[model samples]
Target: MSEHKPVPGHRADYRHFHAIQTRWMDNDVYGHVNNVVYYSWFDTAVNHYLVASGVLDIERSPVIGLVIETRCNYFASVAFPDQVDVGVRVAHVGRSSVRYEIGIFKEGEDSAAAQGHFVHVYVDRESRRPVDIPEAMRMALAAIAVG
Candidate 1:
């Protein structure tokens, strides 16, 4: 088996942040937040930034991003009543896809409790076929892009 390299979880590594309040139901029987909840945070952070940047319109946009891949790595446990600040950055932008990296930090913490990435393939809303990212969207993404 290959060794896993730890993902960087520093706040300085990301360009944008979105806060999410942990819900009581987010905890699984294991007592910590469920692994699945992290993915939702990732989605929320990235999409929220896009929407706020005026690049995404969930109801009327001609194009929409579809998540094609996702992953997460946990470094610490998070429980109920905690506020998570998810840091977001774009690692790559392709013709029709973007790779968003996210770090989940406890409120006011500089280090992340979890980190992950997801790839979104932009597509035509009606046809469900891949389409070039809109110029406006690309410009929005560029503001947070990293090498």
Candidate 2:
């Protein structure tokens, strides 16, 4: 594997964004948002976009995306009172999987507090077998594809 240095990101680096409110429970003993909570934000940002784009129906879709891999790099800390702006973009799209890159920014900040990516493989909801991405999903993802 290649060494991936934790480089901070900027808002302009992402294609879309969703506002996420940090809950008090999200903070750890350090008084900042816990590392695990960032992953939840990542999931929320990506899934929300998919659902809003009409590409995903969590309850009724025959095909669903299953997270296959994920990673995050924290550059700074965020607190409960902060409104996190989660920026999302598609780094790559494959036959059955898509790599979604996410950036968590403290509201109004130009630089990202955290940045990372998760790979989701589309699969049969019942059979759990990999399936080609649907046309609607492909189009939606393409809209967010990063150069």
Cα lDDT tens digits for candidate 2, 40-102: 999999999999999899999999999999999999999989999999999999999999999
TM-score of the candidate numbered 1?
A: 0.96
Q: Which stretches of candidate 1 lie over 4 Å from their true place?
A: none
RMSD (CA, Å), each prediction = 1.0, 1.3
- Expressed as tens digits, the lDDT of each residue in 10-129 for candidate 1 is 999999999999999999999999999999999999999999999999999999999999989898899998999999999999999999999999998888999989999999999999
Worst 10 residues of 1 by lDDT: 1-10
TM-scores for all candidates: the values are 0.96, 0.97
What is each predicted model's overall lDDT from 0 to 1?
0.95, 0.96
- Candidate 2's TM-score reads 0.97
